[model samples]
Target: MTAKPLIGITTYLTRARWGAWDLKAALLPASYPAQVQRAGGLAVMLPPDEPGAAEAVVSRLDGLVLGGGEDLDPALYGQAPHARAGAPVPERDRWETALLSAALERGVPVLGICRGMQVMNVQAGGTLCQHVPDLVGHDGHNPAPGTFTDHAVEPVPGTLTGKLLPDAFGVATHHHQSVDRLGEGLVASAYAEDGTVEALERPGGGFVLGVQWHPEAREDLRLTEALVRAAVEGPF
Candidate 1:
């Protein structure tokens, strides 16, 4: 029997309160692993580690998943921290970057969700709009803080995201930030009604896609399945 592909997902390293203990823990929403498992991949949580440790970890995994989280520090993209920017997660930022760099170097399939997508952009020398409402002039993309809002996104044909969601579909979105400049070698594959970049992909035989929404939060598992399929197929 063929082995199920191993999917490594980065988890948030933050203070937590659980079962009579409060300490910094590496935790991820259960939805992430649930999505991966439902899509037929073995899910593994990767905690923040020393920068040099990522390459060895990537060498063993079939694919990588960067899950959603807080707003990123603008300094990484050569800007001062916006007043709305979440507290700096320097460790996570460095750790995820190392993981992404290793995965890209080894041609491993990657699926970045929400903040994960932003990390991908910055890692590739791109910038981000500090606040979505400031640019779009509305709160449609993210109507409430800490809650997802439904919005339709039109996917461009002939791209990774487009192939999966060819038609405009509603996705769960809860972000205040959006991609600004296009990252080198990255293509914007989908956009919201307000022209907010909804999805991005690296056009190549390998699977490297990022969506500005949270797929795991929704019942739709197309994106997760695609990542598993890519892992099974290996690099092209």
Candidate 2:
């Protein structure tokens, strides 16, 4: 029997104070691993590290999933922090950037979610809003982070995402920051009525899709299935 495809998920660093030492440990939510397993892939949590570490992780993985969390460091996009930049986690930002770059170059199927969406964009020479609420003058995106809210988005007439979710409109959202400037070679496949890019994809590349939503957090399994299919089928 063929072995299951190995899917690597980028992990976050957590500071746990124990004894006299502040433990810097790798952490990720359980949903990601559970999602991968449900989709028939063996999930591996890849911790953020140096650039070299990113290459090492990519080499052993059949596919990559960029999980959601935190905000990207402003320095990555040649900008100063906005008033709402929050606490910058440079290490996680750096590692995720390297992972995205390496995965694209290696043609590994990649599925990015929420903050993962922003990481892919920044890695590809794009920029973000940093804090959408300040710029947009509203906070509709994150009405309540954990609650399921529906937002209307129009998908591009012809694209991978369009093919997956083809209709007049679609729903799902929970983000404060979003793509402000698109990355080179990426096409905005979907957009919210407020003009935030909700989904993105590379025209003729492998399964390189990013969604500004937590599909794993939802009860639907189709999103996870699509990613696993792409990985196992060796990216279209």
Candidate 3:
């Protein structure tokens, strides 16, 4: 049998309650690993660790998934926190940033979802809109706390995301922020009807892709499958 591509997914360091255990935990939604496995790859949860450890972590993985979580510290992109922005998780911010850097440098396939996309943008020197509702004039992007809102997104033809999800598709969204100034070398590949950037990609290669929606929340696994395929094929 062929060796399955190993994919590392970043998780949240948060307090949770499960079976009478209320304590801090390294947590991730079960859907993430389920989707990864459905796509024929091995999934591993990567909790926030000390800075400088990402290099070692990335070295062993064929792909990386920067999962969703708290808002990034505004200081990361040289801005002050927005009144509506959620509290920052400094440890996760540092670790994931380093992970993104190391993965990019090594040409590992990367898929960024929700806040993961934001992290990728900020790491690449991009800024965020902070509170998207202020610009779009609606909370449709994030209708509730801990619940996903439904919205349609159109993928730009000729881009990687467009090729993978060519039609205008519905997605589960739950974010109050959106991409503002895109990162250097990153191109907007999709958008919501209100013009919010829904997807971004590094042009000219290497499977660097980010989406504002949560694919794991849905049954479609094309995006995850793409990452697995890229990992299985090795570096471009």
Candidate 4:
């Protein structure tokens, strides 16, 4: 019998509050695991460990999802932090970056959401617009503090993103940073109305894709399904 693909999702290492206690925790949003499970994949959380431990950790997974979290250190992409950028999570940056490289080397399907997408770009020699509002002149991408902003994204036809999403659609978004330069061998697969790069895909086409939105926060399961499918069927 075929077992469900084991999907590893990266988590945030930060102080979280629950059960009358506030403490540092390795946690991911419930929606991430729920989304993976709903897509017929086994969900596992990958917390920030020693950066050197990533290869070993990734070797055990069928797929990898770089879950969204804090802003990456500007040093990662050779830039200084924007005045508006939040503090960096250096541990997460190092761990996730290593995990991404290891997963890519091993051909594990990857789905990068929000900050995850930004990480992928940085790891691939790309740059970021530290302050998105500086580019778009508005905070529409991240309209509220905790609430999601709704906007339309147009996926380019013939790309994996386009294949899964197929056309323009409204998506839930909450981000203040964006890809400023295309990564090596990566293509911008989708875009927002203001020309913001909303999605990216690796050229070799082995399920290495990233989107600048929270797929878990929405009802659509196509991205997760595609990751699981790739893990099950071996790259398309």
TM-score of 4: 0.98
Q: What is the lDDT of residue 89 in candidate 1?
A: 91
Q: Model 2 off-target regions past 4 Å?
A: 16-23, 145-148, 168-172
Identify the runs in model 1 with alpha carbons over 4 angstroms from their true place: none
Is candidate 1 or 4 superior in lDDT?
4
lDDT of 1 by residue, 1-236 (tens): 88999999999999999999999899999999999999999999999999899999999999999988877788899999887778989889998999999999999999999999999999999999998889999988778777888989999999878888889999999999999998899999999989999999898738899999999999999999999998998743
Candidate 3's TM-score reads 0.98
TM-score of 2: 0.91
Query: TM-score ranking from best to worst?
Result: 4, 3, 1, 2
- CA RMSD for every model? 1.1, 2.5, 1.0, 0.8
lDDT of 4 by residue, 1-236 (tens): 89999999999998889999999999988999999999999999999999999999999999999999889999888888889889999999999999999999999999999999999999999999998999999899997898898999999999989999997999999999999998899999999999999999997759999999998999999999999999999988
lDDT of 3 by residue, 1-236 (tens): 88999999999999999998999999999999999999999999999999789999999999999999999998988899988988989999999999999999999999999999999999999999999989999999988899987899999999999999999999999999889999999999999999999999998759999999999999999999999999999643
Q: Tens digits of per-residue lDDT for model 2 on 129-223?
A: 98788767877888886675777778778788888778745465777789999999998988888878898988788899998977787666766
Per-residue lDDT of 199 in model 3: 97
lDDT of 1 at 107: 92
What overall lDDT goes with each candidate model? 0.92, 0.84, 0.94, 0.94
lDDT of 4 at 136: 94
lDDT, residue 130, candidate 2: 82
